[model samples]
Target chain A: MINIILNNRQESIDVDSMTVQELLNHKNFTFKLLVVKINGKLIKRDSYDEAVIRDGDEVTVLHLVSGG
Target chain B: MSEMIDTKIRQHLSRFRVGIAGCGGLGSNCGVALARVGIGELVIVDFDVVEKSNLNRQYYFLKQVGLPKTEALQHNISLIDPTVRITSHNTTIKSDNVAELFGGCDVVVEAFDRADQKVMLIESMSLLLPDTPLISGSGMAGWGNNHLIRCEQYGNLYVCGDQQTEVSPDVPPLAPRVGIVASMQANFVMEILMRKKV
Candidate 1:
């Protein structure tokens, strides 16, 4: 088990290493306009599957909602 | 005989140009407010036409129901202040032309309604115009959550909205709520423009 800070909140995941896509799915972050940043580095949409997040990584998933 | 005293502030405001990404609810209303506030130049882009339904929240008149949004908005702003330069592009904003369109502006306003489009604008702008500030709106639908609407800053991106209210059948985009967010976006643009160079 590894603990990571997700959006200013710490959460314990059952994996030592997981891709950004995996972390998003695990957290159920299905927002279409989410901007993901791992350790202050932005992860592009295409690179989500390749970007890996390890223990103690700081991740911020900003949900940009749909409206006007 | 120059009959002017506070020409410094007006001249300062007339030196900057702002770009509007989508001339829908937020864009239309924000554009009007900026124009009224004496923004020097406005670069607006929109491929959609004004419909009767847009009259609810958008800043358009009944006579402009069939006109293109960019043209109609240009005319409205001209009526407000003909001296204000309005350069409008009546076309769809894609990633390829995003920089060419708004690269020169001091600030860009992302007023798109769709989440995908918002993402596209933010991604393209962040890559193309890294230094330019982007003011966007999200979740300004329906009403009664006036207190929830707020502005958040992330790097150069400033988003003004509740950040949660997704538009659905139950939560439609009304005037007051949309206006609140639009005013916030315009206010941000004003603040960015009014800042001293450092």
Candidate 2:
């Protein structure tokens, strides 16, 4: 089990490790214009598939799009 | 005391500079609101030219249809406050140049229409201008959810919108809701500027 903070909430997930992309999928964050950060560091869109999320990592997925 | 506070806020506003990336629905309206409130300077960038369809929500007149959006917005803002200095850029805002364009601004408003563009600005500004706040609009399509339109902050980023309303054939970006979110973004800039002074 992995205990991590999603947004500002705490959650315990079944996986011990996963990619940022997988974490986003697990949380169902389908918003296209999302900015992801792990432990205060930004994970660029192209790096999402490579960036790893582990136990107790603070992951932030922010949806910053509504249209102009 | 209230009058003194107002005077101080005005002083702060008059010394501040803001950047508006993309002079469209959100940028044009936000720029005008900030100018009306006496913001000292605005750095606006947009590559597109104003079209007849833009008049529906953008702060542009029919006569300015062929003009670049940045130029049209600058002209419109000047009409509101002649003292407000504006530097208009008739170019696209990309990730690599975010810092070069808006590095000196106290705050930047990300007002792009497409999701990809919004993400580009938000991510670039968050990284390049780590100290400056980026206020953005999201989910302001249709109308009448005044209560739902709110500001959410994430580090140096501020997003204003319903956070769900995507612009589509069915739910198009209208003036009322777009103005609401844009006004909120402008208002947040004032709040940030005032707080910085304190």
Candidate 3:
């Protein structure tokens, strides 16, 4: 069981192993232009592939869409 | 020649002082527009030089290439309105000098191209001038639909860019998009000075 926190919401997901991209896909989030903070450290877009989701890891995804 | 002026609007605009960081694409357009419309005072800051590439979207001429942005922008505003009191800062806004750079400014405009600088400026404003309005720009890129441009206000800070739902890495930053965002920023400043809802 992996505990995922998104925008301050906590949820437990049953997945064997997952990457950031896969998690976003599962959430139906298609936008790639986003800032991912895992435990308060920003994960670069390119490093999304190397980041492995772990159990009880907190992740915050902030969408940077157009807003003035 | 004494002319009749809206006493309320004149009184409102007279006391406002605007600070514009990054005098490049968005800053140039916004600064010029503000000065042209008789804003009380404008403090323009930029640590860049005019390059040939900037002519596309910046409110400068080809002859201004190689000139310091602050100096060139000061001249540009002078041509627009000689009476507009303009202050130019030829250095970049940093954590060390942000307070002095933007001090006494009623509104701060974040128009830098670098994302880190934008974040830094916002944080600095939050710390140094929490009560002042910070109008920021983001997602003014690509050649998408013009109607997508919108303005949002968050407390004392306002952002003029695309909504958080439509952003892609493929979106290339361009001048026209930035211009639209800059105009929105100017409008927000005007509204704030006019005591209108953002």
Candidate 4:
């Protein structure tokens, strides 16, 4: 079981050994132009697949498109 | 007394200062719109000069081709409103002087053409002037159909542009799209000064 906190809400998911991309997919976030902050560090888009999500990790996703 | 207070508030709003970076497509239009609407003080910053290529989108006359963008924009703003307090900085906003460039502004508008410069300006503003609101644009190029723009807030920062999956480095932005986004930026600044949440 992993604790995924998104935008300040905590969620319990039954997934083990999942990559960042897989975690985003599980949460139904399909936008590719998003900036991912995991534990206060920005994860680059190229490293999304290589980064692993552990238990009790906090992830904040921000959409950076469309604004003046 | 209420009438006096209204007069004072109007004076403050008229004296509200805005800083515009880049002075290209988006910057030119934003400055013009702000000046036309009676924004009292404007600080225009840009390091580039006018070329034949910029004449398509940039608001400068053919006779002003060799002039710095900041100077040309100041001239244009003067033509629109001679009483407006307009200052032009013919230098780039770097890490060292960004704070100084944006010092007394109520809001900072990022209208740079380059994505890298835009990112750098945002980071610098976050560090230097955290309380000042920053409005930036992205994805205004390559046949975008959505003319009505949406603004997304990030703390004190607001960004406007299309939500494209990938941004090509070489894609040239057109006038109509950049104008749409720049107007939104100016409107956002107005709303902020008017105490309205964008």
Q: Highest lDDT, which number?
A: 1
* Candidate 3 C-alpha lDDT tens digits along A1-68: 78777655788888966888888888888864565656645566787788877877777664454421
For residues B61-160, write the lDDT of model 1, one tens digit per residue: 9999999999999999999989889999999999999999998899999999888888888888877897899998988888897789999777678889
Alpha-carbon runs more than 4 Å astray in model 3:
A1-68, B1-11, B163-171, B196-198
- State TM-scores per candidate: 0.87, 0.91, 0.72, 0.74
**How well is each residue in B104-193 modelled by candidate 3, as lDDT tens digits?**
888989888766676667667766787888898876767667887777665566778774423256665667887888899988998888
lDDT of 2 by residue, B1-198 (tens): 998876666677999999999999999999999998888899999999999998889999999999999888888887877899998889888888899999889999989999888888877876777788889888899878788988877767788998888888888898999999899999999889877862
DockQ of every candidate = 0.58, 0.66, 0.17, 0.22
Error of 2 at A15 (Å): 3.9
State each candidate's clash count.
0, 3, 9, 9
Estimate every model's Cα lDDT from 0 to 1: 0.88, 0.87, 0.77, 0.77
Q: Identify the superior model by TM-score, candidate 2 or candidate 3.
A: 2
**lDDT-superior candidate, 2 or 3:** 2
Q: Show the lowest summed lDDT stretch of 10 residues, model 4 chain B.
A: B163-172
Each candidate's fnat, listed in order, reads 0.74, 0.71, 0.27, 0.16
Query: Which pairs clash (backbone N, Cα, C closer than 3 Å) in model 3?
Result: A65-B163, A65-B164, A66-B162, A66-B163, A67-B161, A67-B162, A68-B159, A68-B160, A68-B161
